[model samples]
Target: MTTSTTRQPIHTSPINLTFLGTASAQPSSTRNHSALTLRLGSDAWLFDCGEATQHQIQKSAVKMGRIEKIFITHTHGDHIFGLLPLMAACLNGAGGTVDGADDPRTQVNLNDSPMEIYGPLGTRAYIRNGLIYTHTLLGRPYVVHELRFPGDPQDGDFTHLPPHRSESPNGRNIPLKTDLNDTGTWRNIYSDNVLSVSAAPILHSVPCVGYVVNEASVPGKIDPTKYIPDIKRTKTPMSVMRRLQEGEDVELSDGTVLSGPPRRPGRKIVVLGDTYDPSPVASLAQGADLLVHEATNAHLPGIDPATKETDTYESVQERAISRGHSTPQMAGKFATLIDAKKLILNHFSARYPGDDDVNEEARKIMEGIRDMASFEYDGPVLCARDLMSEDVVLQQDNR
Candidate 1:
């Protein structure tokens, strides 16, 4: 099912995936580069910040001010060019100005909480250079956490890169850290009270990684009317209801004990970077509710010679492998392997005429895989477009 790309309605589901931009390598008339936002409760976690991502957010329902964390896949320009601008916009109160003025004298404090950024090695350098050249400073400093796989290049080991020429010597530089963990292990990168984020290295041209966002399981709804008819007739105290909602057994004055409903498993959403092979994401994305994978190209019938706009020298599969990208078929197989309930194909090539073409091709490939393996995966294969939003509904299954 597809919907308009204007705004996503408020949903009861705990997690939501909003595709800010879905183009690959470059922007097109209808599609932007790679960028998406995972809205968990009131806060937002951005996956990538490709070119014009801030503009895309402005067009969608996602609030830039709520983006507390950003995860970059690689250093490619298409994937990260818009990051600094977005940061600047966030610092400017999402209006591109501080205190409603562009003048530095009227700059107002913004971003009360420090924004955390996660990416592979060289992320620090990239952000440092962008901030330096742009002359952008935040009222509340941000932090950059660099994620690296085993044996990756190690640069200068400062905990955090200091600000470039501090104007208000009082303004603190954002803390930085190099989180180097064993390769192929899903290491906990960040966590809060409501959600936990983990990352694992994926097959990309650069030191890229995939991230999984796991929301904390919540206790199912408890109805006092069903458990205790006397309490419902007399109206139980709010405190007693709160205790039951907190998953604690409560006893009323009548000496009758009431137990809360069982706690259901939380939802899992996986966002994969550009990868030619999907094997790396298998273990990390097992049984995910939503899998956002890149589909750079489809297995088109004929190869048109290289034009000024398109690459000419290699076949679709050859180009995908050599450039560390994935085809639609590869993405479908990966989703099948991971048992993702729903698949959202993103980062489409500009060559595709429309979303229907991309969705059809991917579905055909997925169907082929199911037939070959004698298994069935009937989940939706959505072709993501800029500003498209999907609500991730958690399954109640015990599996």
Candidate 2:
């Protein structure tokens, strides 16, 4: 008797998302302003191209030709000021926009495609205005799809207010409520067949958004040749194996059935371009495999590590809310609230020099928060730095 064991082949494509820049409002010696490259397949999703992002890219393995989508969270100078130079240089290398895409490629070469810019309304006009003043240098076409929210930015979250607010006569400076402005309101940004993007407003002075990118499930591969009948069974040709790998389940006249293993999603990454509280982004970021939160105010090393578990540790939550960015403690709390598997806090303020300060701060747990008053969800936390690349993929267990 012949025995054949089928191993459900799990093929995983490693996705390496490199942090090109991770500063919030300003760039310091330890950190640069906002910029990130989401390596989804061969394409790259650029979030908030701040000043010097192109320079950062040049220093990394990110091929300048691979950047496809540039999603600007807001028009803030720190978030999008560097767009002009990045766009111009990319276009110039690809040729001119209106007349540039015609570049012919040799057998081994491929021409760079138009870069898609995704942002708020008037983005096209803003880029054009910048380009108009600058000399003609690039010729690559890019389309900006504005992501306009349903409501205003500065208004408090109307969805989270108690229902009794309406009953109160002439409420005391309480803001109006709306489900659209809820803490967990997530809006689907983009989707094709396999992958989709969703985003929600993060706590920021401007109309900023934190995005969640998700890829669809992929079925596992099966070995049809293993299902061959035992009566004088013959080895199937390589062509047959290829077809089976393509999900062509088949039954032979000899009564053999071939099947594949269970299917599952690739992975989930909760990447925040630049945010503070990010309470509004909870819905979109719920159950994220990884949370890349902004840790603009982690100054932990100044304090002793023993104080992390002690009652004397001061919480940075208030400072985070006031500054419109998150502290390490707040970032950890946000990650825990969203059921994230891992928390990576970066985007430090220029004030803190060297990542030792960042590591010290993020590691310093908030001793100030009393358990009775709130839920301080603390999980695994790590700080992010520019030029650092991390691997993330959705596994079946994550699903």
Candidate 3:
């Protein structure tokens, strides 16, 4: 139940991911469900808010007010049961007035801005019904955006669509579509000055998507030695130093020109929902710094007599595929195909006794991935647990 308020690293380049819940369909004694928070800069983005997610958040250090955007992978109860409750809590703290003014512990300012929720077609209706049934009056306005592919030929390419703004049924202004480019791979779903999010359709029981959050590349660190040969002797004006730090070329009075350093690539993290097929995920998460994928089962390809008393490995895999879920081995192979730097497997089946069993199962999957792939992958394979937080560092190419 450790909070992430002070756990994030001091470095701003790397984003921090906190696993609020890691169980799949069923809740376990240790794991709650599927929910994760990505802290970038001062804001936080949530992926897949599951049952009792608000409780999980309360036990952790993530601020409800900092969650500006929520991206639900699908309509499954395990992935979205906490959406309405969390929204309500954000507007009005657990013990506060509707406007959150009565609660002394409420951290979020009620007048800041409305939270934007993005999901599949039924997202808007789902939120509406939840509010109606619960008699929840939103103290502040909230917007629910449903993702849709345009039918027109010109707008067919999801990557080229412009940001579409429209009013929601609740009279909130919501952006229908986000800014995109002509990548023809994944569709850009949202973007701001700091981060850009993209999504790709993946095969699943319901309309599901995997999101990619790419932090915008930042200016590289300035090499003072390259610009200022003699630090103690060089008497540069304060304005010239400021210009150089801002990545601008500066000319001194003596006609010396110093060029700015190149930009450094930002970090990329991919969070996917339930899916049997991993091809779309691999494409969207190519070379991602971190890949957070669901490992709902530990099914192997062939039948294993050891597990035949209850279910064979082959039978378990069959069920997983039939139900549109991924086994740990499948998730590992997908991460290998995409060459992800690190693979954090979560959404574990409640059948696993504890983290030890989960890690052992993941190890077997990683071994399989190494054997199948041509290149050997020695990257870290983390078995995600509830409340486990990890820093997603940018892998700088020093070579």
lDDT, candidates in the order shown: 0.69, 0.61, 0.68
1-399 per-residue lDDT for model 1 (tens digits) = 011123232224557789888888878777888899988767788998999999999999999889977999888999999998888777552222234357663444433346777787777668777676555655555666676556755445332656432222222221223345433655556655556777777888887878887766666666767755756755766667766776778777767788878766678888998888767657767988888888786543332122234543256658788888877667777888888888887787776433444566544443432232222346677777678789887665723
TM-scores of all models? 0.76, 0.72, 0.77
Q: Which stretches of candidate 1 lie over 4 Å from their true place?
A: 1-14, 93-112, 153-162, 165-183, 221-226, 229-239, 252-256, 302-315, 354-376
- Evaluate model 2: give its lDDT: 0.61
| CA-RMSD of model 1 | 7.4
The ten-residue window of minimal lDDT in model 1 covers 1-10
Q: Residue 371 deviation, candidate 3, in Å?
A: 11
Clashing pairs in 1: 159-176, 160-176
After superposition on all C-alphas, the RMSD of every candidate to the true structure, in Å, is: 7.4, 12.2, 7.5
Across 194-260, the per-residue lDDT of candidate 3 in tens digits comes to 5678777677898787888876666677767676663224577545655676577766656667777
Candidate 3: stretches off by over 4 Å:
1-13, 93-112, 149-186, 230-234, 238-242, 281-283, 300-306, 309-315, 355-377
Worst 10 residues of 2 by lDDT: 165-174
